[model samples]
Target: MICIHLGSATAKNLIEIAGAQTTVCLRIALAGLLAMLIWRPSLRIDPRAVPGIVALGAAIAGMNLCFYAAIEHIPLGMAVTIEFLGPLCVALLTSWRPSNLILAATAGVGVLLLTDSAGTASWTGIGFALLSGLGWAGYIVFGKAVARHTATNDALALALGLGTLVTVPVLLTRAEDLPLDPWFLIGAVAVAVLTSLVPHAIELNALRRMEVSTFGVMMSMGPAVAALAGLLLLGETLRPVQWLGIAAVVGASAGATLLADRHTPAAPETPGEHQPIRPTPSEAVPVP
Candidate 1:
């Protein structure tokens, strides 16, 4: 995740040189290419897995585009916090426990405060951030299904390949302005490796083992990560409340991740009473 946002900060730096659409098309395309080189998949996808793969690919494309558009207008951390709504929704909807609710609310309060800190940002940035959040939610929901069939690296590789395909139109539209300068190209390669390749592959591996809610809580840390990235890399300073928000989100993530795993209670059963078997944490969120 740190790699992901660091790549994003790198892209943000290049936006002025390459424009948002062009930078994003390049990032996705290059990342997909690297993933393909590593995985070298046969593209022999199961019919059942097609929908999930397609959805994940589309979600990646939309999320990347919208998030780039958002950061073009607002700071990276602010945009990421707004985008957290997507996974937070996934966490609550997939499984509901009182502990989950409290932790999610803590994260929610953090988002509110962070949002408040960005008092003067335009609605356009916020709207794009919201759209990005929706795309992220779709990514998480469909990603699990894809992982089940394709495994980790292949799943992310194939999805990024599809996302790269989606960028063809944009790339063509911006072809005239695209840069070939060696320095910029170097940064782009780093961006591809950090944001597009490493973080997503990590996410796929993590999602395969953990419950969606656990994953979501873990992902709730993204805002903090992005915030720090923005501060350190881009010099985008945060207000005191924004720092407070990060602390809240971190606390919620720590508590929920531990609590969700540790608290599987055994229901008492009488000799004749049949106890319904519960789904393991990873199985709680079904693809259907």
Candidate 2:
């Protein structure tokens, strides 16, 4: 929400400002610092896991970059709704429960309503949003693989490191557009806090106390949250139809999660480990 408002308030071109190249660099740098300060991943090298970690970082970077780009061209609410397809896809892909099909269909209809409005809709932007969703799905799959081989703290740090390395080239190419003004720096920090650090910290803490299905159900409210943020921060009002669509998507996501929780077996507890149960088939793990 902050990013959308800031980007719009500025005279910059949204595509150039929020494209795959720029956001990747910024997120990599910001998240890398946060993860390193918080986790301090061991310097030890795991030769076998390096490739997977690199791929995971790349996917994470791609997801952030693409989603920011999509939002550059669409309302934050609409962008979030479309981008949410990634996790929804992950949920449906892993589950075979017949009941989830209805939830999936409902989400699909909501997305259609979100993107089909004549005057406000941009097909190109919607295309970018879909692409962002695919990237997010990729991020979750690869991130889970990385998490399996290392601690979340270490894995996230490494992923950010790799992402930063991957994004350096693009950052250099766009150096001229980089903001150096003190106020812009302040705004960027605010964006980092609102979109990245705070959410990551809160969610990570929450995940320690919750199940994957429960977490999924909770996170399904993100679009609605974003909508609320948009209303408060940007004075963006949703039409009745759009509000209905938002409700449908939120309801379906929550319903699917609840159903998954009821039917899925509880995760096994490890002996001597006091850590909370981690959700399987992780969702977007939002960076922005």
Candidate 3:
């Protein structure tokens, strides 16, 4: 949670100069490089998995682009609170209980409070955030699809690389805006590490030791964490109502995840290999 917020704060600090496109391109590009170097995934992957990889890569690429663009137009906390609807939707879709509908309604009210559309919030930004949420949902679906065909790390590395490729045209247009100063370049690299490389490494390790359901529930705290990051790191304060809205979303996420877990059966552990669960895009953001 902390690392995810830190990465978000770091990107917000850079977006003024780098712009959303450049920031996302560099971050994912660097992440792809790091993953390739570390995993050295087979260059000759099975052909059957290409479509899943492409879809997952597109999801990651689209998610980051929309999400960064969203924060560019809206407050960090509000944007994240809205973007979290993706995973929340996934959690709800997994179960058909009446409680899930209540949870969904709670999240909707929370979003309404956060948007307060009649006031200063930009509907355009909200739209982008919603699109990002959709991208996030696609990410989880395609990630699982790809995992069914290949090793997790290899698929992820390839996805990162392919995502970077998908963003290349946009990156080209913004390439001239990329910082040339040594310190600024360093800051960009640091953001990449903080946002992508570090989180990927840590999440990969953590998944080996934790259950997916537990991780999902913990991830439900993302909105609160992002709100704190906005307050502390970005010096952006939320109104009391906004805070309540955030709480509602977080509570809904945790509740939905727990309920889904209770209703679903756990997969048996593999006999010998210590296989980690495939990560959702949200889950990829390291907690600390």
Candidate 4:
């Protein structure tokens, strides 16, 4: 929803509003504040985890940078279609259910139709979007491990801290583009709230109570959400083929979730175990 609104507003005031690089830098700043307030990590450092944290931070920065760049060159919808591959890959690697295979195919068809639309988006934009997706996938894997090793709050704070450090040089290079208008700053804050803070909080809360596979299946609805957001907020209408593609991905995702629920086993009694039980080959678990 924030992305939709931001995109619309930016479209109107591209010159007045900060570009993607500046907006993302503000997002990092806001995220850093939120994480610090929530996590309040100790000054004590873990040397072993620093490399992983740094890598995750770089990936996050790269994903945002590339995504913004892609949007500048292509339609917002198409850019998102390409970026969706990141989470899709994460979901695929973590689960091998036959139903999920169908889900994957469905999403693939949707992406194909979405990108093949009238805009004739450049291969460079698509390539950048793909790179962003890969970065997102990396972010998820590393983030999960970090969360496991430390508190979610602490891990996120540390990750953001690292991200800030990594992004400073880029931010410096783009400093001249930083918006001086108070409204632009406000808009940046709004974007951070919607895109960074809200989504992260919601996903973290949801993941705590649900399985990763289940989360992935649910996230398959993102394109539909983005489309709706585009329509309602940006007055960007989708064509019939695009609508069909959205249905395919959404349907497959829902189907996968249902199938997984049927196959998951009852919980074991290890009360102290940090992680949830891994679903068996034939087992599926419902979102709690």
Candidate 5:
């Protein structure tokens, strides 16, 4: 989470100069190339894995684009809070117990407080953030499916590689805005490492361990983390109410973590949510 926000903050300066399309294109493109180099996915893969990888790729590509565009229009924390609604819904709908709704509502009310949708321009940011949420939901769903099939991050590497395709048009269109200097290259690489490479690698691994709802509940920390990133890195400020909202979000995540029962049966698979996916035997070798 810290890395992701750090990347967002880092990307902000680049976005200011290059525009959101160009900055995000560079970030994703570099990340994809690096991941492909690391994993070197086989030319042949499981046919069953294709849909999940494709969907995950599209989701990741779309989500980053929307989020980058939104941060250009609004504060990073606010954009993240709005974008969180996507996974929050996945948690609620996939939860078997009625009690989880309270957790979601607690987080929801907190986000409502953080959100200050007043002007047309702010609404435009909110609109993009909302779209990012949908893409995020797609990520949680398809990511789980893909994770179940792969022992390592091969699937993720491929998905990211495929996602680069989505950036081609954006890069071409924004070619005029892109900086050709070495400093820009350094910044773009940093953004890719912090945001796309680190976060996705960790998240895909986490999905391999826990249920989607559990992961979603835990991800309630995103807004608070992003807010801190905005304050410390971007010099953004939050109102007292927004601070309260952050507290609520943080508290909810902690509460959910403390209260979760490992033995609890996860809700059965829905479209975006899934039954607990155990790692394949290749992935399940006992830790030495």
Candidate 6:
């Protein structure tokens, strides 16, 4: 999930140039446009899939907006660490294996250590991050349902479009100050592609291949990835404890994924067809 982390890093840069709400709105709009252009999904959608698509769209909008807001008041690593709780919760609830529970506790400890290293954090940021985490959990749940009931690309594209629509009122308030210079536009587009389009594209495909619990456990690496990106791109430094925290998360994720693989039940393949019982390592995260 380097792409997701990279998206987080680039989002920091974009938020500096524009307000959090505006940046998020623009990013989703551009990504939606790109998805629609490429996929050209039919206008009509199955009635059964409507609620899932709408919830998925709303969750994406909420997640991005809350995440951007959280980062405004806290360090990227800290925000991501807190926001990760949503997916970690998902992993635990979906799979109640002793190993998964242990790993979730391990991740919790790592998050506590990571946050401690960030010094005094704003409670507002913490709240926002928690809400973002909730949104993320919803995104995964509804996303899985959407992917199951509809064409993957079409569902995602439509959801993004709906997200953009939901954010329009907020975007309008800042329209007068929105950057329009050629150079700024170029950067905005780049940010939109990296932060919105790429990760969603990779993840939409990945969700179809792996179980949601497996996906969440793998995505638990996002904070570590964010920490590394912060160091390289933003010149942020991690403390010894924070380093240990990253290690804890990484180790737990690896162990859980491998454990899940060994115990995963095989499903029968269709006639004349063969599908891998478990997803590959790279397929687990879908980084490009």
**What TM-score fits each model?**
0.89, 0.76, 0.81, 0.80, 0.88, 0.88
Model 1 C-alpha RMSD to native? 8.4
In angstroms, how far off is 189's CA in candidate 5? 0.6
| Candidate 5 ranges with C-alpha deviation above 4 Å | 116-121, 261-288
Q: Number of clashing pairs, model 3? A: 1
Provide the overall lDDT of each model, using Cα atoms, as 2-decimal numbers.
Answer: 0.81, 0.59, 0.70, 0.63, 0.81, 0.77
Write candidate 2's Cα lDDT for 125-216 as tens digits.
77887887887667556654554455555555677777667767777888886766666555444454455444443443444334433444
Question: TM-score for model 3?
Answer: 0.81
lDDT-wise, the better of 1 and 2 is: 1
Ranking by lDDT: 1, 5, 6, 3, 4, 2
- Model 1 scores what on Cα lDDT? 0.81
Candidate 5 Cα lDDT to native: 0.81
lDDT string, candidate 5, 136-164, tens digits: 99999999888766533677778889878
User: What local lDDT score does residue 156 receive in model 2, on the 0 to 100 scale?
Assistant: 59
Candidate 6 local lDDT, 56-131, one digit each (tens): 9899888988998998888888889999999988988897577777887788778777877545779999999999
lDDT of 1 by residue, 3-61 (tens): 78888899998898988888888999988887787666557766677889889989998
The TM-score measured for candidate 4 stands at 0.80
**For residues 134-202, could you state the per-residue lDDT of candidate 3 as single tens digits?**
997787666656655566677778888887676667778777888887877666666666666556545
Model 3 worst lDDT run, 10 consecutive residues: 268-277
| Model 4: worst 10 consecutive residues (lDDT sum) | 279-288
Clash count for each candidate, listed in order shown = 0, 1, 1, 6, 0, 0
